[model samples]
Target: MPADVPGSRSERTEGAARPGGVASAPEGGPSQAVDSVLDALDPDRDRPANVIETHGLGLSFGSKPVLSSIDMQFGRGTITALIGPTGSGKSTFLRSLNRMNDKVVGFRHEGDATLDGRSIWDPGTDLLDLRRRVGMLFQRPNPFPMSIRDNVVAGVRAHRIAKGKQLDVVAEQRLRKVGLWDAVKDRLHDTPFRLSGGQQQLLCLARALAVGPDVLLLDEPTSSLDPISTEYIEAMLAELVPALTLIVVTHNLGQARRVSHRTMFFYDGQLVEQGPTEDLFERPTNLQTERYVMGRFG
Candidate 1:
């Protein structure tokens, strides 16, 4: 049986990973600092590939399994959408993919999540580095309290990457990528919170891009925005999927139909079904999927 997801758009997820050492060297200096890490983190043409793969991944809150025996794959340049009832472990499973579950006190997982074939569960894994590679956008725009310019460069600085004009260049380029450059181009020194909710969200996106991630996770990214803002985000998502792996969790099945390349339906903490978006939405392999999509339950 499929668990019914309430018809609406308000599911969300969290987390991060790191990329190569692009933070230490300033500007255009040798990207060599990241070389050592490249073999392990880079998506270079000849790299072993595979963005994120989980094996028998399970998690529990106080011994009550929140997620169970989860095995999944996230590939480059694709959009994977997580869908399910409000608390069916959809978000739980999503966070575990990047070890965000580790930050939840008392949250424990029985299996492993691997990025680029490296186990994230390893004691020696660098959390900050992992987060950079797996950039995340929250449901709300949570930009740091600072000049837009400063906020965008914060991740770069934290990663010990380039600073000053070079960082500014990266920030600007990312702003352009998110379609925020034209809106806030003149407000680089303005506080981020002052912008409209939608613009602030885009700024946060710009900040994420300044770090150049291979995968980006969006947790109900447009739930709080107006229709126009929602459309903006939806459109941006479509454009971004070609260069970055995107994992979007949403209650809005319509949004899933529009933006996701693949969709997974979850129920009772289990993945009931998943497949190419059009087929799943149009032909629906399972009865639960059919009911949920038709508003019969969920």
Candidate 2:
């Protein structure tokens, strides 16, 4: 695996090491671990601008096609929104990026998806580490059955990025980043189920961030939240860009307009249109895209 790729095993090992010590914090303390985590997540300055690319990608379950001939590139530190009516293959494409559909009963794919200029399905690629670099947040908040703090640091622990007191640092830093620290600080050990729907989602976001991913894949992230919570998540997303890439699958056209720099329209298993967010929404080149954006039909 390329050492420069975020979450690569080599980067993780090197970043977590002190001059003469193992892959853990030195005498400099938890701050060192925190800094290491952040450094590891940063994309290599000389890396290709497009963090992910799909080439003639297609998908099927058994013999039923889901997505076809989908070619796209997701620029580093940019947000692209996938938008379309239900059953339009938007979610399927999103899931394919991280190979989330591989275990489905009859999932099959064509062509390729690449990360950092290498095929994601390369024989040498490590699935667990690939998932670490390409994290995901689902349609609903699915916090683990653990304490709030534990929920936040779950990935960090799983990746062995930090441990002992360092886990606390990672948890607090991530929770604060997602604006959940102040709300859940007093109940760090309490079960996450007690949090409100919005709070739980934020907690999930924090958990995703703790692993220091290079790309984040979101599927209808704000769909379940109220207006206020939705606003909160949207704002948080805006703050993450230029540091982490985001690909979001959403049904809400308005949310797509608000949070994405680029937008793609998928219909009947084909990519109908894609362009800058403003242009795609305001001057859609395709008749179908124009109608859908104008509320003629989903």
Candidate 3:
């Protein structure tokens, strides 16, 4: 396993119950378990290309389970849409990817979530650094209480990615990336709150990108924008793929089909189905997914 996972597989899995309620390894003893572990941990192991993966993932707040048995992988440089009804745990699963739920009251998780084949909850992992690698955009624009330029560079400055004249370059480049530079260039020093809601959301996107994240999480990014603004954001999102992975939680099925390469449907705390966007929409394997996608029920 990775350095952070620590302990031999035998040490971790010995005496653990196997299928059929077996209490321990067979006649070969723990070595059998060790061999299985080695196969799984082998660096040369053949597997699908993925930037983020979850294994039998589960989540709960205190005594109430909110999500269960979520096994999934997110391909690098691809956009995956999470579509489900409200309270379906889509947002919870999204927030868990960056460890945002760590501080929530009664939050608890089972199994593991990995980035680059390493456990995200590893003791050696730096929480701040993980967040930098997996940045997030929220349902609405939430600009900092500072100048427009300052907001764009807030994360950049916090991470010390650039400074002095370089900060100006970073801010402008990111702002332009989100297509907000020309509109806000004249008033760079003005408060971001004064900008239109759509502009403010774009500014937030620029801020998230300024840190050079590998994966970006968006929760209903265009929910509050006008149609024109929504189009702009959607277009910008398309341009970001194949460079940065995107995981979006959206209630709008049309938006999911428009921008995502793959889609996952969540229903009543379970991952009902997932596959290519077109396949999921046109030929979902699960009845729950079919109903949800066809607008029969949530």
Candidate 4:
């Protein structure tokens, strides 16, 4: 395996201590994870210059606030990991990016969240288009009750984006992107249940990628998969970050340390701290963040 590859098991911090040990932090060089992401970033590609900005973004469900005063900027094409204990509003914050929270009754928010400088809450904002641009993958693999090919191309087909050969090409490309095409190429017509648990999750990712999203919001996307499957998805994500901004919510501090370029810690509906992943994990500025990262509690 390449030394610079994200999730490269061989690439460990100096003194090579894996996260969660009581070992002291390594210093004097870029941490392994950040080095990998930086190496993977393309210098020649025309990346998104626009930022995803959230200002005073607070959300409440029937008078119960879940996210409060979140002012942050996630740069284009960066991989950001959201971490904290359960009920810290990580998932709620992710959903708000694409307005998924509107489904809840009495859900209201303050301030603004924007993708590429466009306000997502604008009355005239096309909800469908917004969602398509900011695609989401949930905790568990939720493949539709359909053939593999159909599931992969569902969104594009529904939006009338392509047909016949073009649709077929799209399906093949996305499946291949997620490294599932070879395994399922001959079984495209088979139902999703025919796939193993990992394959199904990769299929869901293909479904999301088929539509050409600008940002991929993953909510613990590998939580339900086996170790090997988790590895496959993490590798794919590392590859995808160069093309799209990725915001992932994962409670596994080790996973966050391994894969994210930046990390954000949330607690009781407020963002306590955020910065380069290594700094946040190895030397958290906030006491709460330090405790959480150290696995003291959640």
Over 7-67, each residue of candidate 4 has an lDDT whose tens digit, in order, gives 4422322111221221243454666565445435634234335458899999999979999
RMSD (Å) of each candidate, 1 decimal: 10.0, 10.3, 13.3, 7.5
lDDT of each: 0.77, 0.85, 0.85, 0.83
The TM-score of candidate 4 is 0.86
What are the TM-scores, per candidate, against the unseen true structure? 0.83, 0.86, 0.84, 0.86
Candidate 3 structure quality by residue, lDDT tens digits, 47-161: 3358899999999999999999999999876789999999999999999999999999999999999998999999999999999999999999999999999999999899988
| CA displacement after TM-score superposition, residue 92 of candidate 2 (Å) | 0.5
Better of 3 and 4 by TM-score: 4
Order of models, best lDDT first: 2, 3, 4, 1
Count clashes in each candidate, considering only residues at least 3 apart in sequence or on different chains.
17, 0, 0, 0
lDDT assessment of candidate 1: 0.77
Give me the runs in candidate 1 sitting further than 4 Å from their true place: 1-43
Question: What are the runs in model 3 whose C-alpha is more than 4 Å off?
Answer: 1-48
Query: Which candidate, 1 or 2, has the higher lDDT?
Result: 2
Candidate 2 segments exceeding 4 Å error: 1-43
Worst 10 residues of 3 by lDDT: 12-21
- True lDDT of residue 239, candidate 3: 66
